[model samples]
Target: MNITSHHGDDQVRIALTGELDMATTEQLRAHLDHTLISRPRLVLVDLDGVTFCDSTGISALVAARTAAAAAGSHLQVVNAHGITAKTMQITGVLEFLTTPPGH
Candidate 1:
């Protein structure tokens, strides 16, 4: 997987592409750690480009959400479609990470 990040004000937006699985989870976590050092007010993960995600990816996302909450920031997942959206719903993690309409 590839992760590209952009920052504005107190928010950080991360665009993820490719597959997120066991092999890529660590890389994603590392990126999240680096981004959190800036103490962003919000972290938005754009998953529109992500083609696949396994359980490991889901765990990483949950961990990111927990970290953001602990830092008094918000975490959101954006532009998720197809199986990714379905997996998030089936796993119940979407309730915590979903972006609001119009975001």
Candidate 2:
């Protein structure tokens, strides 16, 4: 996957492209870890460019949300489409992952 990020005063927007699977999940985790260190109030993950997502990818996203919660931050997953969105919905994580920042 290709990940790019933009930092703001209280938020970090991460845009991801390509497949989100086992091979690329570690990369995403690393990015999240690095970003969360500063305790940004919001971490927005944009998955518009992610055409495919496996179970491992969904796990990664859920883990991200959990990690953010543990850090007293918010992680919002957005812009999911096609199979990626379907997977999230079918797996019962669509709403959990897509909750708006700040509740």
Candidate 3:
């Protein structure tokens, strides 16, 4: 997977592309760790380009939420489509990552 990050004031937006699985989870974790250190007010993960995600990827996302919370920030996921959104919904993790209806 490839990740592109943009920061504005206290918010950070991360755009992810490709597959997020065991092979790429660590890379995502490392990047998130670094980003959390900035103590951003919000972290938006744009999954529009992510073509695939496995359980490992889900775990990474959960971990990011935990990290963001510990850093006194919030994490929101956007553009999750198809199986990605379904998996998240079924796993009950969507409640934490969702941006609410009109957000």
Top model number, lDDT: 2
Clashing pairs in 2: none
Q: What C-alpha lDDT values do all the predictions have?
A: 0.88, 0.96, 0.88
For candidate 2, the per-residue lDDT at 88 reads: 95
User: Which model, 1 or 2, shows the larger lDDT?
Assistant: 2
**Residue 18's lDDT in candidate 2:** 99
Cand. 3 Cα-lDDT: 0.88
CA shift at 7, candidate 2, in angstroms? 0.5
Q: Worst ten-residue run, lDDT, model 1? A: 94-103
Per-candidate clashes, comma-separated: 0, 0, 0
Which regions of candidate 1 deviate over 4 angstroms? Answer: 99-103
lDDT of 3 by residue, 20-55 (tens): 899999999999999999898999999999888889
Per-residue lDDT of candidate 2, residues 1-103 (tens digit): 8999999989999999999999999999999999999999999999999989999999999999999999999999989989999999999999999999756
How well does candidate 2 match the true structure in TM-score terms? 0.97
Worst 10 residues of 3 by lDDT: 94-103
Candidate 1, residues 1-103, lDDT tens digits: the string is: 8899999999999999999889999999999988888788989999999998888999999999889878877788898888888888899987677864235
Clashes of 1: 0
